[model samples]
Target: MTGGSPGRQDIGPVRQSVDGSTLSTSLEAAAARLRRRFGGRLLEEAVFRGELTYVVAPSDWLRVLAYCRSAPALSFDRLDCLMGDHLPERAERPFEVVAHLTSHTHGHRLRVKTALAEGESLPTVTGLWPSAGFDERETWEMYGIAFEGHPDLRRLLTTEDFEGYPLRKDFPLQGTVGGRIRIDLRGKI
Candidate 1:
């Protein structure tokens, strides 16, 4: 994990609003606000399919999410999705934790992403959004992304004895072990 401040420089350029509505806030504006508040902790920003996406530093993920949830102007109250992706090709950061945040009042959706190398830990966002607990646990079990500070960080999909993250790109396609034994009581010889 790279250790640095949040707002060392400004984010992407703000384009003119297409809708021309004063109430509507552009993604650039939000990124700028977050950059100012967090100060260089936010790593990158981009727009995809009209959704604002920000790649945040791992160390600052919790702080950024907490602010986004509690701040009245930027109340990203709804955590629509929390998932993990594995990028084996990427040498520095092989795993990514993506979160989709929705602001019902503001009618805006933001995607926050934090990248992690193997064995690095990601802070849990369940404190800001309780729904994250399940997703985090699943990520932990599937991609082996350990979420620090999770109240109940445990396997949600896989068994306790399960080994290795199944979702990694390098994971084998074939099964390593069979499921539990099944007995045929009706046709017992």
Candidate 2:
């Protein structure tokens, strides 16, 4: 009932910092800092099972993430995961690339994701976090998403002759391009 807003009403007395200034939870503060820094580019916010997720637009993906890695308040220096997913249910925007970031300095975790419309590609984060090299390559091969400036994006798991993106939701269950195994006719079986 104190310090409320029109869209998001405050629940109770806002927590106070040691200096007696009103404060929000650390995660809430992080979200607010990102919101201030990104404005509309930071698209949506979701908290599921106590985990914070920030969905940014693909247009500003690289800039926002770079800010996260460098900003003093945010400093999301470690890139834990950079992967892609196909969500047919989303319909309009079916492809999504998610990055998990951790701030060892502040002991905070954030999940950042950007939705892509099937054929679109995201900018490479290898320059920001060199550890993302392998994950970006794998995501590129599996989801058919290219990291625009990746240094050495080659096949990580599948072969060069692989026809389709195996990790896509629409990919065949058994196999697509690879030769099928004849279990019954094979003498080894």
With a 3 Å backbone cut-off (N, CA, C), the pairs that clash in candidate 2 are none
* Number of backbone-clashing residue pairs for each candidate, in the order shown: 7, 0
- 2-79 per-residue lDDT for model 2 (tens digits): 121223322222233334333337767787787666665655655654456767778878998899899999889899
Which regions of candidate 1 deviate over 4 angstroms? 1-8, 15-28, 178-189
lDDT of 2 at 22: 35
Question: What lDDT does candidate 1 reach at residue 184?
Answer: 52
Of candidate 2, the 10-residue stretch with the lowest lDDT total is: 1-10
Q: How many clashing pairs does model 1 include?
A: 7
TM-score for model 1?
0.81
Q: How accurate is candidate 2 locally (lDDT)?
A: 0.76
Cα lDDT tens digits, model 1, 20-59, are 3222355456666776786556666655556766778788
Candidate 1 local accuracy as lDDT?
A: 0.76
